[model samples]
Target chain A: MQELGSFLEVLISGLLAGVLYSLVALGFVLIFKASGVFNFAQGAMVLLAGLALVRALDFLTRLGFPGWLAIMLGFVFAALVMALCAFLVQRYVLGPLINQNALTMFMATIGATFVIEGVAQFVFGSEVYPLRLFPTDAWIAAEATFPGGILINKLDVWGGVIAGLLVIALALFFQYTKTGRALRAVADDHAAAQSVGIPIDWIWFVVWLVAGLVALVAAAIWGTKLGVQFSITFLALKALPVLIIGGFTSVPGAIIGGLIVGAGEKVAEVYLGPFIGGGIEYWFAYVLALAVLMVRPQGLYGEKIIERI
Target chain B: MGQFKTSYAKDMVIFPIRQDRIGVYLLLGFALVLLPLMMAFHVPPFRTDYFLLAILLPFLILSLAAIGVNILVGYCGQISLGSGAFMAIGAYMAYKFGTGISEIGLPPLPIVFAILLGGLSAAFFGVLFGLPSLRIKGLYLAVATLAAQFFFDWVFLRVKWFTNYAPSGSVSAPELKFFGYLVATPVEKYMVALIFVIVFALIAKNLVRGNIGRQWMAIRDMDIAAELMGIRPLVAKLSAFAVSSFIIGVAGALWAFLRLGTWEPLAFDINRSLELLFMVIIGGLGSILGSFLGAAFILIVPIFLTVLPAELGIPITTGTVSHLQNVIFGGMICCILIKEPLGFARLWQIGKEKLRMWPFPY
Candidate 1:
């Protein structure tokens, strides 16, 4: 009974972790679909956004604003800053390089990631800051009878709820809006969409803006959960494996990949760890996906096109 | 100019010009012989020799790997994120082989052979990963390679057999030597690396200029046309992977033998892989000279940043220094890309062109 309870706890923690991973993957998918460039900076963007949000809140408090109002103001101001970053990236960095190859564009994104991480460090010193996403008193106590009891954090539950709502909101925005429709059209075929007079440039910019917002939302939740640190950017590397398993183009794949990798790593660590000295289970998720990739190269939902000479 | 009156035979020469060939020969001879002598004479503790062997050996290893990758990525148009993992395979394989042989009282030559063999094993993995390139395009292929990186890193770290069932879960190279010359010394180690790099780089240059290289370039420029032109995509890609893996594996062995001498799996972690890939990308793809230039830029700039600030009495904190280094390094990449997206090689070519007309404005 104790073993069963521990397994259940591991599984639940993995699912919550998966939700955050999915959020980061979603940012990659948005920019990839619109611009066809993998935003290598997405991970760093998460770190920068979270740091900015914390700074905004702190700045407001220093100016004598109430705590709650300060927090709210921080959220809005951070979003605006992210949007501006998107616009500048598209206008100056990406727009000029539109004629360049994918490798060049990818290198540019890497450059962006390094530059952002540095600027963030400069702006907000390299210190881990705790983020208060919600009230500390918001707790729900539930007890389950087993051989031994397990303790679960109430805040983890809130993180799940907020992440779910955010995912749904994003899904609706992408599915319903005119911008979303155009974005999909461009993703499907850039040249054909351009021939039909869609403003390809603006679509890329807006989609990148949306990706930044997605990053902001993920960062806030994750930052609050883990505490904000410069090393948090490495966590974003976790999303790449998810992206690979989920299929680069599918939103549903991100969610599924997240759950599989998250739960997979936890279970492996708990069950198979003693066999090989343990901590390597952190990388086991990726090994599992590699096997999966050998079977399904285009990913689960990615388009299957056989190239002919 | 009797040299200018040279026949088509002279024009078609591999070195084309005599002075250039002499320069190349002199440079190679110096690297192979002179570097070892210099290292033997010098013993400034915590100074140049240590920097050259400790840091530069790994950078050279990464450069060789990047060159291998450049053949596939820059020249052949396939993107990969798995170079570091392939390197890990070489490192671990060398460790396993060296230790296994030493247990039987075998010499270091067998270990050297084992490291190359280790690289061949990584090439096998590369082919397995490259199989996806037959179906996927661009970013998809890159992601597939990234999966390989993660998988190999996990397996090597987790599997006890790879680490010789070590308690610490980390592996180290056995003390290596060549012809009874202790290779553990910085000078000896640097010469070993210098020799290997020059030889492999020449081989890579030859491969790129040969028929196989042309076939890879054909595939890169336009796969459909290459396919139509009777080139098999599978053969071209897999061969590129094999060659790339072989070079990367050798570099990985050198990294183990020379650089860390002792390291955990994280030494060849994803960050290292990305850094190497960036070295190739920022340096220039598809150019042999770019491999060296990129390695120099990526490796030397950070050192320069670290020392230059201190020399000026800035007294920058290590954290701030590293952060600033990251920013400046990244910014320089952006600036280089923006100014000449073709990379540093092209910039060098442009400089050469300008130099020919240097005395008076054209």
Candidate 2:
């Protein structure tokens, strides 16, 4: 029973962490569906966004501004930086090589990733900066229901709430707005979207901007857990496994995939890690994703790939 | 610039222009005779151990690895991110062959044969990992190959027997013995690497121009059309993975034995994979000469960047230098991908074409 209680706690925390993964995965799905570029630089963008926000917040705080105002202004400044990044990427990096092969596009994004990582680190000191946006404590509840009270991290719960809100907001944005419908049209068929008078370039820019914003929001919450540092970029690697499991194109898939990965890896790390040595989660997630990939090449929620000669 | 071939044999000649033939002969002569003499005689600053060990040795092996990568990615159209895994397999397997045979009654395998066997073992794993390429395509396949990268990385780190139970989980190269001759000096190591690189490169160059090469290219360009034309995707794709892994495996052995001499799994990590991919991309996909050009570019740019700043008496921190290097390196890759996807190979071909047509503008 104690084991079961601990497992549930682990599972809950994993699910919470997984929701944040879904948040990052959301940004990737946006760019990939719209651009077919994969945007390997998405992780670097998060690092850049996080650094910009933290550095700005630090400066504002040092100037003796009120806490709320500093946070608000910092977020605004970060969003502007992201918008500028979106414009540069869409216009300069991805625009010229529009019809090139997928490999070329992928490589270009990786190049962009290196540049972003380097410049971001160079500008903002490569040291960790703690952001107290969320509670760093834990809560003990349901003590009578489970042995020794199921422990829960307050930060994880709050992060989950924020990630959930962002996902809902994004879902609404993608489903209802006129621009959202146009983005879908562009994703469906680029040439057709252009022929129908949809501004393909504008739609692409909007998608990139939205993707950048998603990363920034997630970075805000995640900054509290891991601290804003260069290691924040590794979140992108974790997101890739979630991506394959959830299917590349589906929003809901990202959530479900994140939950599975977060819970699955957390559980495996505690239980399965001991006998065969620890630190299996990294490759365990990949192996799980590969198994899923072998069974369903497209993914659980990804669109069926149709081929014509 | 002009097609003046009278026969099929003439059309298929390695060098179509007279100057190209003379240029290659002169370059080979310099590498073979002049360079070695300069090194042995300690001629100026060109023949130091640092020059041989740090620059040229790695240049030869990395260029070879780039060709290996080009065969799969550039020619075969099957993208793989598990190249570092294949390299690890080659390095570790070759190390095992060198030391493990004597654990039983048999004598240890010769180093040269161990290297070849290492390549073969890597090829075997390559085929194993390449299995997914049959069903997966494009970016999906690229991600799937990550399975290979992460899996082998774990295997080498955890599996004790592969490392001959070294305490540090790292292994050192055994003797570089060849036919009762010890290849001890850096110069000797460079020569050995040069010989292997030249042989394998020629083989790669010849193979890419043959029927199998055409099949791989066909599969790359349009798989469905190639399938319709009776070019079996399985054979072409697997064969590509096999050949590419073999070449890469040999390069890996050379890298471990000749370049580092003592190394850990960290030596062939994800960064190495990215570096090799950069070489292939910046050099030009599907162009063998581009492999050498790309390797040289990727390898030398940092040295040049670091040195040029110091030479100019600009006192910059190493961190800042590295950051600037990253910006420049990555920007170069993006520019190359956008402006010239064919990369340095295209630039070289254009230069040659211009030279061929110098006397006549049109």
Candidate 3:
């Protein structure tokens, strides 16, 4: 019973952590679905957003703004910057290099990754800053009656709630909103959407903006947990395996894949890590994704890819 | 029109034009003779300064690795992010073979053989990680390769056997000797790297120009069509992986033995993989000349950035310089992709064409 309780607690914590992974993976899926380009800069975008927000908050607070007002202003500034980034990316990168191969676009994003990281470091400096958006102490205390007691971090719980809400909101927006429908049409077939008189470039811009918003949320959650640092960019790499397992174009796939990877790594680290000298979490998600991909090339929820020669 | 080949044998030569052949021979001759001549004559930069030699050695090693990556990514179209892992395998395996063999007190096998063995070991692991390419491709294959990168990193860091059970988990190359001649000095190391680069570059050029190279190009263009045309995807893809890994592994061994005499696992991390990929992309994807060009550009720029400020008596810190370097390098990559996606090799080709048609717009 005690072992089972401990396992349950670990599983819950892992799932909670998975929510953040899902948020980052969602950013990748949004960009990929619309543009068919793997944005390697997505991680850098997360880091940039977090760095911008924290710096903005710090600057605002130092100027005698209220805590709540500073937070609100920081978020608004981040949103504007992200929108500007989307526009600039469209103008400088996508517009000029239209109809290029996927690999070329992928390479461009890598360049964008370096630029974003450099800009972030240059603007905000490379110092590690603790994000105090949420309370540090766990809100839920362990009960003595339960075996090993199950303590839940309030920040994680809120993170899970926020992630769930974001996913739901996105789903509704995609299903109901006109712009979202256009975005879907674009993702479905770029030529078809363009032929139908849909504003392909505008849709792309909006999609990138949405992805940026998702990146901001993800960074916020991750920053609260790990603190804002250069290493946070690496945490974004965790989303890659999540995307692979979830399928590149599937929104729900990102969520499920994130959960699987997050829980799977935690479980592996706990049960199998000690024997192997720990740090197995780094590669565990990738290995799992690879194994799963062998069975389902299109991924668990990804649409089957059909090639006609 | 100035020079014409009369026979098919003459036409089939790697450099059919006499001028082209002369130019290539002159370049090779200069490379072979320049450093040794400079050292003998006590030339200022070559004698008093080891910095140029230091940069050249890694540039040569990285060029070789980039060439390997080019075969896989450019020629075969299998995007791999695990080149660093293969490099690690080569380096550690070479370290093991080099140290383990010497400990046994057998007749000392040449360092060249140990390096080859290190490359072969890397090839073995490359094939293992490459199995997923059969099932998935493109971005999926890339992520799978990332797994290999992380896995090898963990293995080299955690598994003590690979590092010879050192307390710090870092290993240094044993004395690199070729038949009792120690290759210890910077010039000797530079020569060693240059020799490997030249030999491997020749092999890569020949391989790409032949039947195997055609198979790889066929697969890269359209795998299904290649299969329909009797080119086995399995053999082509795996061979590409094997050959690419072999070259990369040798480069990795050279990197350990020639440069950075002592190293840890962090030396061959994801950033290294990204740097090599950038070299291949920025150099030219399918062209061998691009590999050398890309390697040279990536290696020299950082040194230049560091030294330029000092030379100008500027007061910038190293961190700021590095940060600015990243920004500039990143911007350059984007500019190259946008302006000339075919990279420097294509630019070189364009220059040559313009030279041929000088003073004639047509």
Candidate 4:
């Protein structure tokens, strides 16, 4: 009973953690889908967004604004920052090198990553800033069913709820909005979309802006959970595996993939950790992703890639 | 003088121009004979051993690894984030061979042999991880290589057996005795690396100019077309992986043996892999000269940056220095990619061409 109870606790936490990973992976998917770019700077964007928001939130609250008002104002400031970043990146950095090969663009993003990281840290000091947006305490929901009630983190539940809502909103935007339709068309076939009178550059800017906003959402949850720091960039490492598991183009795939990775790594760390030196979560997620790649290179939900000479 | 190449043999010569050959000879002479003599005579810049130990040694070793990366990425068009893993394999494997396990009654191998063996092991792992390339392409392949990176990182860090049960996790290089001549001095150590780099670089240059090199380039250009045109993708890709890893492994072995006397697994992480990739891109992808150029630029520029600030009497914190380096390098990479995708090597070629045609133009 004790073993099962502990396993249940690990499983729930893993699923919740998976949502956070999905949030980061979601940003990668949006850019990759629209621009055909493997944006290495996505991690840096998250850090930037988190920094912009947290610093703003801190300032606004210190000025004696109400808690809710300060949070909303922080979101607005971060969104503006992200919008500026998108315009510059999509307009300047990615604008000129439009038709270059994937490899070149990828390298450029890595370069962009350094620039973003430098600017973000330079503007907002490199010290860790605590964000108490979400409650960090836990709730035990099932005392009668198990020996010890399953320890559920209140923060994880809030993060999960926020992520779910964002996904629903993004799906609606994609399915219903004209701009979203244009974004999909561009993603499906860039030349065709452009031929059909879509503004290729403008659409790319929009996609990036949306990705940046998604990153803001991720920053909020992740910031509150871990206290925003440079270490947040490491989230890119975690998100890459999720990107592999969930197809790079699928929103639901990101969520499910995150869940699988979260649960899988948590279970492995708890059970298989002692035998093989612990901290297996990082590589364990990657190895799992590698296995999935072997079986299905396009991932669980990615469209099948057809090649022609 | 430009019309002297009358035959195929003349055209195929490594340095087709007489002036180029003379220039290369002069450069080699300086590196081999003049540089050391200058240090011995206590020249201003060469007065301190810091130039030899800190800058030149790392530059040479990194150039060797960059050459390896250039072979795979620049020439063959296969992106790998696992060079760090291959380097780790080379380092750990060399250490394992250099200091044999007592339980197996195996005497420690010669340092040269151990280094070669380490390179061979890295090449083997390279081929293994490279299997995914057959199925995936582009970004997928790049991300997939991270599996190797993370896995090897864990193995070296956690596996107690690899460290020879040393109380401290860090492993120290054994004595670098080449047939009983101990490389005890910093100059001797530099000499070993310089020789290793020159030999391997020449070999890499020759290999890339050969038939196999053409095949790798063909696959890189378009695998399907190359396959239809009779260059086997499997063989070409795998051979690229093997050769690239072999060179990188040697660099890793040399790095462990020469540069870092005492080191830990953390030394060869993802950042190291990224740095090697940076050398390949910022230097020149397919050009041998580009690898050396890129390695020097990545390494030497930071020193200049650090020195310039202090020389100006600006008291800068170390963290700011590092962050500044990142911003400058990152900005340079972007600017280079946007304006001149071919990199510094291309710039070098353009300058030489212009110089050849100076004082006149069409």
Model 3 scores a C-alpha lDDT of 0.88
Off by over 4 Å in 3: A140-145, B101-109
Q: What is the lDDT of residue B186 in candidate 2?
A: 84
Off by over 4 Å in 2: B1-3, B101-106
Best by lDDT: 4
Cα lDDT, all candidates: 0.79, 0.88, 0.88, 0.91
Better of 1 and 4 by lDDT: 4
Candidate 3 C-alpha lDDT tens digits along A180-270: 9998999888889999999988999999999999989988888988888899888768999899889989999999999998899999999
Q: Cα deviation of A259 in candidate 1 (Å)?
A: 2.9
Best-to-worst order by DockQ is: 4, 3, 2, 1
Cα deviation of B50 in candidate 1 (Å)? 4.7
Better of 2 and 3 by DockQ: 3
lDDT per residue, candidate 1, A1-309, as tens digits? 777777787888778778778889889888877777888889888988898898888889999999889988999988987887788778767887875767678878888888889887887778998988764343322345655455455666676687778778878988999998899999887889999999988998899889988889888888888888887897677887788788778888888888888888888888888877677555676666666666886677666646554
Candidate 4, residue A53: lDDT: 96
For candidate 2, lDDT tens digit of each residue in B146-231? 87788778888887888888899989999999777899998888889989988998999989999999999999999999999999
- Lowest lDDT block of 10, candidate 4 chain B: B1-10
| Cα-based TM-score, every candidate | 0.89, 0.97, 0.97, 0.98
Residue range B198-220, candidate 3, lDDT tens digits: 99999999999899999999998
Worst 10 residues of 4 chain A by lDDT: A118-127
The lowest-lDDT stretch of 10 consecutive residues in candidate 3 chain B is: B101-110
Evaluation by TM-score, superior candidate among 1 and 3: 3
Q: For residue B238, give model 1's deviation from the true position in Å.
A: 1.7
